[model samples]
Every structure is written in C-alpha cells, then in structure tokens.
Target: MKYKSQQIAYWFFALCILLFALQITYGFIMGFARIGWDGLHDIIPFNTARAVHTNLLVVWLLSGFMGAAYYIIPEEAQRELVSVKLAFVQFFSLALVGVIAIVGYHFNYWEGRKFLEIPRELDYLVVVNVLLFLGLILTTLFKGKRQTTTAMVLSMGLLFAALLYLPGMIWFDSQVMDSFFRWWVVHLWVEGVWELIMGGILAFLLIKLTGVDREVIEKWLYVIVGLTFLSGVLGTGHHYYYIGVNKIWLVVGGIFSALEPLAFLGMALFAVYMYRKGEKKHPNKLALFWTIGSAIVSFIGAGLLGFAHTLPQTNLYTHGTLVTAMHGHYAFWGAYAMIVLAIISYSVPNMTGRKRFDKTAGHMAFWLSNIGMLGMVVALGVAGVVQVYLERRLKMDFMVAQEETKIHFVVMLLCATLFTVGIVMYMYEFIRYGKPSDEALEPAA
Candidate 1:
C-alpha cells in the first residue's frame, strides 16, 4: 500500500524543525563570537559554525524535498514510487554521507567552500543528485504515464541542478578550479535549481490550498522558472565581482540580480491576488507565510539591499561587511527557509492524515521566528552601515573601529539571542503540536 502524503510530509517537516533548532544553536555560537565572545571561539569556530549551518540546511531540505517527491510523484505518475526499498536506501545512504561530512567539518577536514563543503565527497553529492533525479524521473516516466505538470517541471530542475555539477565541478586543479565551479554547483542549486523546485512546490501547494485554477498557477510557475534561468546564470557575476572577473560582469550581474526580485515580487502579488479572490479561508495561514514571504523578502534582500551594494562603488566597501550578512539573513530565510517551512505547513498534515496541530502554537512560532529573522537582518544591515562609515569613509583602521563597536557586536548578539528565542519557540510548537488533523493538510494561496 502507498503511504499517505501526510505521513511523508509531516515526518519530513519534523526533520526541518529539528534542523532549524540546530541552525539556531549554530547561530548562537556564531553570534557570540561575532559580538566578541572569545571564550566560545576555541570550542566552536567560524568554519565549524558555517559548516553546521550549511550542512544542516542541506539535510533538512533534502528530507523535505524527498518527502515532497514521494507525496506528489505518485499522484502525478498515476503509480507508486518505483521502489520503496530504493527510497529507503537512498535516504539512509544520503543521511550517512551527511553525517560523515558534518563530522569531518567539525574536525576541520573540509574542502572549504560554502554550500560546497561536503568534505572530499564532491563526487558523492553528484551521485546523490543523480540518484534523486533518476529516482523521481524514472518513476514518473514508468509505464508511459506522465503529466508535465508544475511539480514535474520543478523536478526536472532538480535533476539538471545535479547534472550541471558535472561540468561545474571540472577543473585543472581542485583548489582553484574547485572554487570556480563550486559556485556553479552551489549558486545554481540555491539561486537556480531550488528556485524552480520551490516555485513548483508552492504552486502545487496554492492550488490545493486556495481553489485557484491549476492552469493559472502553472502558468505563473513557468514564468518563475524562465526568470530564474534568465537571471540566475548570468547573475553569478555578482559574486565574481570580487573573485577576479571583468568589470562588465559586475554591471551585467547587478542588473540581472536586481531583476531577480521582480520575479519574486510578482509571485507575492500573484499569490496574494489569488488568495483574495478565493471564496474561502484555509486553516494554513502559516503555509502562505513562506510562499508569499519568500517573494517579499527576496525583493528586499536580493532586490533592494542587493541594489544597494550592486554598484561597484558601494560594493568596494560593503563587500564583506555585516550588510552582506544582512542580505544573507533575509534572503535565505525568506527565500529558502520560508519555502521549506511553507512546505511543512502544506504537506505535513496531508502526510499524517491528521490536522490536530495547535494553531495558536504554530502562529505563535510563526510570529516569533519572523520577528527574530527580521531583527537579525536589520541589525546586520545596520552594523554593516556602521562598519562602512567607520572603516571605508572615515579612514579608521578596521581593528581599532571594531574594538570601539564591541558594544555594537554585543547588541547584535542580543538581537541574535532574541532571534534564537523566536526560532526555538516556533520549533517547539512544531515539535510539540504540528500534527495534522484527520486528513491531508493543504496549502493556501
């Protein structure tokens, strides 16, 4: 018998909850050190924090994506997964790899690339990506049953994201060439492949949540995918500005990336418009949060703040300041983290066939986490501005100014602590009371 969608989704979301909790823990350590908490540095340093944060995110997202695949593929293909046993093997195998990579990272055995740091198993990531693509595609294509729906289109992006890595990873030397292709794999997955997946999933979700016509949602999905390719590939230039690329790349990159947010903003407007037209209200306000929130936040981070720094002039100073962190805070949480959570809200209940969650708890967690993310993003941006003011414009030495702003770092820590508290409350609620009712949970537009 096929497993219920609720079962698959909820279990996966539970994993996300756990991952977020771990993320906060990692955040705390990094926040402490950033604020001059030297004592904690010895025990858990920058690399350790970066690895934990990035790895945990990958694991949680993979789990959620798998659950999503299992849930939707069957219905779309008009068949069960090709092999539940294979699914288990794939899951366990990937998890095992993740564990080893994380452990290696903790002990300083990494290849030293953000989002590309899975130890020496760069090939393993390739293997896993290919496995996932085949698993989903072959199963979907089995028995001549196919529905090139939004969900399927998104899966294709996932598959290609993996395939792209082959070329993206090829280089003369591992170090120099590795960093070059590393962003191809990393940035492509995040800003490119995953954007498609998130859009598809969110569309699948909105269709279920609000009674918006599937046709409308699918069309919107196509537009999103097109925008992603248009901007994401060339937009990689933004990072290259500092990585020794031509000046023209800087200009082209900023323009494309600036346009990236417009796509998201379109999504937000589209979803909200649909929600308004829908005749009824769904119980999953939180699911809508990520779907819509991702767009708005992307506009702010990728669009506004990105525009702020896109200029060669501004970037000269803001390249590595807290402003960058500010962008990171909102962009990832809003674009990536929120989508995952939104997936949880939409599919988890369906997987379990139960909707017994504490709405108050979920909403509480939602608001708190939102507050925390906002605080962090704003604080980081402000801190960045302060740094630029002192170091770049004033001709002050970086260290001397840093010593002066030690208190400001403390404030950032406090902001992060507050943020962590919010995330914890949200995670706690999800862990304690995010069970679905006695049916599939649906997404809202």
Candidate 2:
C-alpha cells in the first residue's frame, strides 16, 4: 500500500470473508436438507437457505469488488482515496443492508425473485450505498494526477453494474416482463460488465506481480472488454430460451451464448501469456496462483460448462434443473469468487505488512477449495443429468427423481465440507495477517 486510505479496503475484505463463511454454512444446511436431514427445516427451510446462500455469495463478491476498487483506484490514479470516512460509512451500510436482507429471508420477508430476493425497500438502500461507493471511486480517479485505462475500465464496470440494478428494481406486473429485466441484472452482470471488472483487476495484479508493463496489460484489457460486450450482452438470450420469450431467442441465444466463451477464453490467454512474459520475481506466489488460476478456471467453469447447456436443445431439458445449479456454482466461483480471493490474497500482505506469502496453509486453501468445488460441481452435474433423464426423459415423478438424487447430495455435502475446511483455513490466514496499519505504506516500486 502506497496510500493510507487503501487500508479501508481491509475492512471490506474482512466483511467479505465473514459473509462468505456464512454463505458456506447455509450451503451446508441446504446440502444436508437435500439428504433428508430436516433438523432446522421449521426455522430455515430449503427455500430460505437457498436464498441466503445465493444472496450471500453476491454480497461477499460485491464487497470484494468494492475493496479491490478502493485499493486499486487510488494507486492507479496516483492519489489517496477522496474520502476514507465515507468509505467506512459505505462499508457499514452495505453490510447492514446485507445482514438485514439475509435475516429477513428466514422470516419470509423478501421478493420471490431468484437472486434479486432482497426486498424493494432494501434495494433502495443498496442503490444508495453503491452510489456512495462509486462517488468516492470516480471522484478520486478524476481528482488524481492521472487516469489510467485500468482504473477507467474498473470504474465503468462498477458504474454500469449500479445502473443495471435499476432494471431489476422496477415493478413489473407481468412475470415475463420481470424475468426479462431480471436477466439484465443477473446475466449482464456476471457475463457482461463483471468481466470488465475482472479484467481490470487482473490487469492491475499482473502489472504488480508479474512486472508487466501497464501498456501491455491494458492493451489486453481492451480486447477483453470488447470481447465481453460483443458476446455477453446477447448471451442473455440463453436465459430467454424457455422464459416465454419470442422463439427467435432459440437461434439468437444459442449462437450468441456459445460465442460468450470466447471472451473468457481471451481472458485466460491474456493472463497466462502475461504471466509467461513477465519477470515473475514477486514473492507473492499465492496471489499469482490465484490470479492465474481464476482466469483458467473461469474459462472452464463459465465458458465450457456454460456452453454445455446454453444451447436451446440442451437447455430445454436442463433448464431449472440441477444442471443449471452445477453451472451456476462453478461459474460464479471460478469467475467472480476466485478473482475476489486473488485481490484479497494480494492486498492483505500489503495492507497488514505481513509477509506470509506462499504459506503451506495458503497453498492448501487454494487447492482444497478449488478441488472441493470441482468435486461439488461434478456431483451436482451428475445429479442433474440423472434428474434430467429421469424426470424429463423418463417422465418419472419429480419427487421420485429427487429421491434418486439424494446420494449425489451426500457427495455434494462431503465435497462442501472439504470446501468449507479450505475456506476456514483461508479465513485463518486472513486473521493471522492482522489489521492494516500506516507502517505498511511504502513508495511504489
């Protein structure tokens, strides 16, 4: 950290770890429920648990993105954050809103939308919080001595993400209309603007860790940005295939969504090529592993797996089944979750002035979580295939098919436990790094 204000990112990252742990816990609850352990069914049913699990994933990832912006924006712009105090305010308010939304789920106080389950009133608070966050980021970027492409891409992603949330908040009487707009938020964020955010962060990390020139990295960033918009925007059609939309989406969605993987493929090649091209002297090997790992894994999870069922022919059978769940788990974790972890792994040692890079536990945490998640994805994928064949193909009863899949949920639970253990280890590393301090600040090399 070359600026004291960047320390504000520490708290946000800390919150991210906390919420992520809670998210895993709820995942366990649901996994257990799937196997007929209804111990907490009365208090926290499957529906509520699923909502909390997914929503927490979003909240933690958002926190990590905010933290990345706070940490990266100032350094790239060559100035301190515009307002650290307001940054703290935005942090707490964002956490408060997330906590309230999650708690409300247990009591059935939420919208029925899948990922947009947070109530409309709380959605207003989220908008305000995000606006405050963006205000600080944009103000600092403009006020600083320089504005870099890395910073602009990241800021644009955040700005567009905030704007995209509005469509989901609108009140629509028709279910079809609501679903249409909902994809604007969900698909567009992950597959669209969020890729810009990832590319920006990846560029920044590569510049620091790889000793790669900014011009080289930012050039690749432009390719990624162009690829993302070209493919991802129309990729939303994949969701519209069976959602009562025009039959045209069949061709449109299949073609465009298949092309979506090219963007991710570009990202993967960009990261690996940059890594191979750089000096590679940075001792923060863990961060490098995560940074490189995120790119390659995202291509697999988001690109390949997503393509498997993205076409109308496959999705017609796999829609709303565990197949989607399988893709969702891996894609979100690979693309968004790993990038967040990469940023955190890089920033923590810098902020806290603790040089515990490449610890045994850190390596274990990465491998375990990723392997565990892969195992879980396979479990779910197999379960989904069985489910699709049984219910959709064989025309079996839904409950009977669900009963047949209980064994896979058991496998998922086992893998999730391994995943949770990795997360706990990572969180331990986070705590061991201790709090951020001014002593950590140094002149940028």
Q: Compared with the true structure, what per-residue lDDT tens digits does model 2 show for residues 182-251?
A: 9999999999999989988999999999998999899989988898999889889999999898999899
lDDT score, candidate 1, position 58: 75
Q: What is the C-alpha lDDT of each candidate?
A: 0.68, 0.95
Question: For model 1, where is the 10-residue window of minimal lDDT?
Answer: 1-10
Ten-residue segment with the worst summed lDDT in candidate 2?
436-445
lDDT tens digits by residue: candidate 1, 133-232: 4675555546425675775776786677667666544544645456657778777777788777777777777776687888887887788778878877
**Model 1 misplaced regions, further than 4 Å:** 1-6, 129-133, 141-146, 171-178, 433-445
What are the models' TM-scores? 0.89, 0.99
